[model samples]
Target: MGNETNEFDRVTMFGADWCRDCRRSKALLDSLGVDYEYVDVEADLSAADRAEAISGRKNIPVVVLPNGKHFVEPSDAELRGELEAAGVL
Candidate 1:
């Protein structure tokens, strides 16, 4: 788990199991020991809508940060940059 004092204490990742980028992002978070809530868009249709609303696009792997910022289908480097910017790195 990540630091509780940081803004990334608990993030929300909106994605589907079948998505490659989602899996990669999840792996990155896990490797970084980041605490996050995984929301399966396939299991819950509303999650897809929520992801779209947050990112303003129909893309999976939407990572919702604790500070209300979000990343949609971000690469590992992008994720790292965001985490670092948020003081989670």
Candidate 2:
């Protein structure tokens, strides 16, 4: 499906296709029907560095929420909680 705008504005996820956690998080977000920008670190040469800059760690699936809060490799429950808090769930 196309990534369209939604209540969760400016939500960006930096991840790679090969990463299991990234896939899980992506699926969770999609299943929740929230709009998010997905940047594949493997496709973009600098995306890894950008994700690291946001979370201060070299990890895939750096999820940046609309509130400017970010999570690195967050669990499903943690992600859901944040999304609920942001009124997106």
What value of lDDT does candidate 2 attain over all alpha carbons?
0.84
lDDT of each: 0.82, 0.84
Best candidate, lDDT: 2
Candidate 2 per-residue C-alpha lDDT over 1-89 given as tens digits, one digit per residue, 9 for 90 to 100: 11222333677899999999999999999999988899999999898998887777898788988777788899999999988987767
Clashing pairs in 2: none
Give the candidate number with the greatest TM-score.
2
- Per-model TM-score, in order, reads 0.85, 0.87
lDDT assessment of candidate 1: 0.82
**lDDT string, candidate 1, 2-22, tens digits:** 222333446889988899999
